[model samples]
Target chain A: MADYILGVDGGGTGCRATIADTSGKVLGTGQAGPANIMTDMDTSVVNILSATDAALLAANLPVHSYSRITACLGLAGANVSGVAAQLQQALPFANSSVVSDGIIALQGAIGDADGVVVILGTGSVYISRRNNSVTMKGGWGFKVSDLGGGARLGQKLIEESLLVHDGIYKRTPLSSALLKHFDNEPHAIVRFAHDARPNDFGQFAPLVFEYAAQNDPLADKILKQSVETIEAALDASMHDDQPVLSLIGGLGALYGPRLSVRYQPRLRTPQADALTGAVALAAKLYTQTAQS
Target chain B: MADYILGVDGGGTGCRATIADTSGKVLGTGQAGPANIMTDMDTSVVNILSATDAALLAANLPVHSYSRITACLGLAGANVSGVAAQLQQALPFANSSVVSDGIIALQGAIGDADGVVVILGTGSVYISRRNNSVTMKGGWGFKVSDLGGGARLGQKLIEESLLVHDGIYKRTPLSSALLKHFDNEPHAIVRFAHDARPNDFGQFAPLVFEYAAQNDPLADKILKQSVETIEAALDASMHDDQPVLSLIGGLGALYGPRLSVRYQPRLRTPQADALTGAVALAAKLYTQTAQS
Candidate 1:
């Protein structure tokens, strides 16, 4: 009988699930709707279940093939007091452990080493790991202090675009693009913000990155400021002179290679994605917890 | 005929109108409903008329008794494009100039001199005046910036309070007080936010300030952070090494005494409130425009 493991990285944008074996080989992966516990808990659970089922089916496993299968969820906002407990009770995993999405991402990226993991997707978080100790720097939601995240960058883009549109500042190609994209209606944009979630706003972040890639000054400034926020978070969390660093999440992987050039030798490549790490953690915990 | 001049500072919490003579004698004052432009334009106009009517009634004068009444409106959200123009057309006055509340506050304190004005009420704005040229730093609506304002402070208080109520953080006296005050149901507060206008949230800012004054660490942190935001805005907008500064708006005036110790030599006491400054500007502009 094949010993199977499941891992889920449930983020604000979507839920990603990976089916793997005990030897750490990924068999299949699947995705579903947003799985952030903070915003929509019901949808998140449904998405997680859907993604997991798909991944298992993709791995060619029967519905009840592996009764001994274990799962772990690295879920966004699961660390908010009773959230993890509530989610554990809600999800369909018979043998599972629920932890913060950050912890699992850190584990996936650096395994058991001392390092800083900065996840910058729709939301952003900085996690420092050292010898079984973990410290979180920032993740104060999208409204308050999501400095280097996609939401932050998107907001900046919209604000700057408005400035240029209003003739308050010099027009740039970014402004023109934003005006075109948003149909030049400021109030409509504001109304859009009233309805859109963090992840929805994050969809526009790639435009800023693309503009930055093309060396647009405003876009360059946006990227510079964003990098500074991430750097500051890392500096505050990591006390060591030269701590190993890895990146995860949507933005982190997208910009990880380029970011490595900025941080140079201190930056190390991640061993696994958040989903793989979650699966590994699940299998490891099931072995210990079940035995205990 | 008495050459009476009226000064009206219409805010989110309430509308305050002062009836003073050309000799700068304080005759009477009146208050009414919230007059922030962001709330509802018609309501603000009605509030202004009501407050002005009350001030006139209190002064034992019939309507239109004043020979020359020039009113300055330092209105919230007047900074938005075309909003000031709309407000100017709405209000009934011999002469009126509509501007951001920060502008009139700066003028009230420093007249035509170079200065920085910090208007802290439901929202906050920093304005710089240098040689007749004006510059604005921050105050990009309540959602994006307005960091030190009442709404932002209230949000912090509520967030912290909720965290403690949920047992996410170690309970502090401030948190306990907050929970007791809100009856331990934060969703109720969220409901209030949905139904609230700008001034409604601003009303709770005093509670935080009161707690801070009582030496509560969490309250102190929040209040201190708010002050820091204002200070940063001032610093960003200030042109010279030593620029005159003014504190306007209800919260600004209330907190002005506390801030004076920190700003000391740079903080210039206002000769009149924003209303008077707005009146002065209106009179000047009305005459200039009429002659032209």
Candidate 2:
């Protein structure tokens, strides 16, 4: 049996690792650079290794202690990458397995209990767990869907900015600021959007919330539409039994208060972060198998 | 001086040619293959030449007659390609120049008269002409702004279908039909959307209309949003003098009756097609230069 358990939460923006005793007691944690395996597996591998090393060092464990660890990694973009299955071979840990970053978030939020978790960051994902059965919905990515995610909000703002330029929509305070970024050229907006990745689109989402605070009509309109998407996702995710619901991610708290009235009562603060979820999962997976 | 004026309208889907007498009398017309200069200038040149050859044949003129013709071409994607300026050197015409396809659309709908023409085909372009001056709005292309264009309508429907799959939106008659296109796999929808071009998205737009005819709630919702976009574009295009308004393109007549009541009084059927407008410009340009 492994002497220690390692948990990894890898995402497009960053990578995190947590080390613990076999029983799941906290030991140490560390974070590293972007680890989106789908776009760049080599980079993800390097960052994941660095994150694990940092966690080991922080725990005052020997450099070769990784040989005694059992790891379960939750990584973003795992589905599209054929390289993910081979990731275990490349890792320093004794045993490692890969799952989606969303799963880690789900475990962190609801923990083995039956409930639902909605992550609203650059992308959006809704996952529900009932009777230990899990199902995922939404999070189809930015172009076709992201719904309440920041990337979609930012893209929607750019789309609306063009409408303002075309005289289809009335101008608001945010219009000038948004236009200034594109140099008042609608073609520039189109060009930027043409090659922009989801992260690029997400960069402008904060501007909408800022302008909405000032009572800008266009901003208000955009936020309202976004809030509705969040509400809709919640409606689909929650059941008649009313499972415990938690919103997690950069925009999670931001969207909480603005959600429809019915969702307010059901919304609960997440008990832990994805890294914590990853570590917990690592402990459970290894301990159960080790005993058996 | 050139004895004949040739007008060419080149688009993403097809190329058209018109040959007329110097006095603006129509002599003959021809059609050929796809000619979007932005994506494929070489193709556009080939199709334009073929269209010209066919028009000359229909007019009972020799192939060499192209040397005696002056042409003005309105082409799709003229703005994006520097090759547009050099098109005169590649063409069979004696004197030639290039302009946006939208300009030809405007001239085709209103002729020398002042009015606004909204082209609502696979994509959308809105142009207004007044006091012999012209200004264009919208039609920034898909992914950013097409407003009420069919590509946008279709893309919007696909996005909605995913929402239905996510349980965010309820299943309707249209939902099953849409999911079938992707083999009922949400990830397939994501993959298809990642690489889908504007024309690809446009293909699904007709489905929205088909389901709307049956009173499918999702279809009705999608169409209503699309109509609002079209109406918004119209409001921006219209002026106090209330110049004639024409909706021209594949979905033009379909959207005509669905327009807000306020626009009904101002709406007028287009007088001609883009090919006719091109020939008229060719005649005017050469005849004026000849007199000077």
Q: Which candidate is the best by TM-score?
A: 2
Task: Tell me which residue pairs clash in candidate 2.
Answer: none
How high is each candidate's TM-score?
0.67, 0.86
| Model 2 chain B lDDT-worst window of ten | B79-88
Top DockQ model? 2
DockQ (Cα-based) for each candidate: 0.09, 0.57
Count of clashes in candidate 2: 0
What is the CAPRI rating of model 2's predicted complex?
A: medium
Query: lDDT by residue for model 2 over A191-220, one digit each (tens)?
Result: 788789888989998898889889989888
| True-structure Cα RMSD, model 2 | 3.9
Retained true contacts (fraction), each candidate: 0.00, 0.87
lDDT by residue for model 1 (A1-292), tens: 6667889998777889888886668888888889878667888888988888788889887654436577899987776778788888876655778899888989888887888888877777788887778877567566545667898788778766655654445677887888788688665565566566667778889999888788888888888877876665565666564378877767876666556364756677788888778988987976776688
Candidate 1 C-alpha lDDT tens digits along B186-222: 5455446555655666677888878877888888888
| Tens-digit lDDT track of model 2 for B83-152 | 5786767887767878888888888888887788999988888888878778788888787787688998
Output per-candidate TM-scores for chain A, rounded to 2 decimals: 0.84, 0.88
lDDT of each: 0.73, 0.84
Candidate 2: misplaced stretches above 4 Å? A11-16, A25-67, A77-97, A240-244, B11-16, B25-67, B77-97, B240-243
Candidate 1: the clashing residue pairs are B72-B278, B72-B279
